[model samples]
Target: MSEGLSTRILDHIVHLSPPGTLEDSADAFRKLGFTVTPGGTHADGQTANALIIFADGTYLELLHFTHAPPASTAHPWAHKPPGWIDYAFLGNAGTPSVADTINRRAAADGSGVRYAPEVRGGRTRADDGRVLEWLITAPAPSEGNGTRASARGRLPFFCGDVTPREWRVPLEPRSNAEHASKARGVAYVKLLVLPSELDAYAKELTSVLGVSPAASSASQVVWELERQPSDSQPYQAPTLVLNAAEEYEEEIYVRERGAGIYELGVAVEDAGKAGVAYTPYGRVVWQAIGSR
Candidate 1:
């Protein structure tokens, strides 16, 4: 398997809310100066979402379940709380499938990172009745202590579009991208992990993302995702920061909820002008470019 298959793009980050709370979450983000677009219910009729699109083809997905499916259905959103949940990476459209390649490579490298078989997924646009489709690969379920572990909020999933990307992301009406707070795009995602699990999770991330952790200290590690250069753009890539929970005095999500996405760093035109509101779900950190 060729390296770097998983680093093609950072597709989207997911934030889950309580059942029937999609609009509330969107309202909160709107107050934060984001343009939130209404998304439709999934084909399964179990969940729905709203989107916050960025210029770099990345987005923030605010997801909430409409109703609980039957007990026989095996979806993961049945009992999850509101917070920054899972995230996805864009997969390549070429050659051997990204999911298969990652699984094979993990086996070869002894990384123990395994993905479930690819599955078809789709949603109907509530605004236009248009249907959008895609293929998704998620982590395989594991069992421990006589209980099945959930990959919902903890693991990264892979998505490859079956429909045209443009159809899913419309370009007309450029005003939708504009924000009152001057926010641009995601700067980084902060994940909290226990110190004992840092080395193992770091190895798994290196195998899955095809990027080694760039800077590491006793309390944190950072990985830089791949980004294409544009003539009008400066040099920078969205990052993933894994912080150790034990080193901090304040409580982290991993301490209250579990080891998963703790916060998000959003890039804005000016950090001083940006204001952050703590929604019921997760924390959003607004920072200027090149600021620590």
Candidate 2:
């Protein structure tokens, strides 16, 4: 039996693509005008990722498996095609053990319906002498069985490091000179649930994330998650909301495609500059960005 999930702060959301290349993802974001910074690659030689930085130290990641397993006949990611893959949150510094704690808890909850958590970490140099350490709860190569993506709602992973540098490389501070912009932070992560399975899906998130049951809403159900940035200290708190509904048109297309990030919620200072800058990409999500 497994216990419960232990997670920290909300860091970023991840989108997985396989046959779709990282270059394509980068191109798409480039069309949108946000600076997509280079990020790390998985050790399995099967993945790579890029990041869209925001002011709050929170960002969005686009991931794709560059090299599929040698013997893999059907890439799991193929089933889903292209869209959101998985998302992760940042962790606290001191007593950085959220990964272990989460794995332990999940193992105690229920094995039949729960998946075992494996920890991943190593020395990855992000800046000169600036080593970035991270941890994730994931299935091993053998466990994944060479498959890539699945709608099982992959486990939530947390990241913490010994030396927590708030910002080693400032993510190009807001500049009105070229394009004035600001970070409003993420509003919510929207997901789709079949009319019949809405309740079950909501319960699953609450159980797996240790979040209390939702208060209740007619349009969408929200789950609140609080995170302690550090093991020994407490400070500002932010919440992540998971919304599900059967009537969302966007959800209809994304659901048919597979369960993945279809859209994002971002607040910017100058929707006009953002609109002008992101004009290359199909169009800005914010209505103002396009017109302004």
User: Relative to the unseen true structure, what is the C-alpha lDDT of residue 45 in candidate 2, on a scale of 0 to 100?
Assistant: 45
Stretches off by above 4 angstroms in model 2 are 1-8, 17-20, 68-80, 91-115, 122-131, 139-155, 162-181, 225-239, 248-251, 254-260, 271-292
Native-referenced Cα lDDT, model 1: 0.74
Worst ten in a row by lDDT for model 2: 275-284
Candidate 2, 232-255: lDDT as tens digits: 212223344445544567567546
- Model 1, residue 5: distance off in Å is 3.4
What are the per-residue Cα lDDT tens digits for candidate 1 across 80-134?
5677888887754434577677777678777777777778888997788899998
Q: Candidates' lDDT values, in order?
A: 0.74, 0.48
TM-score of each: 0.90, 0.65
Model 2 backbone overlap count: 14
lDDT of 1 at 160: 75
C-alpha-based local distance difference test score of model 2: 0.48
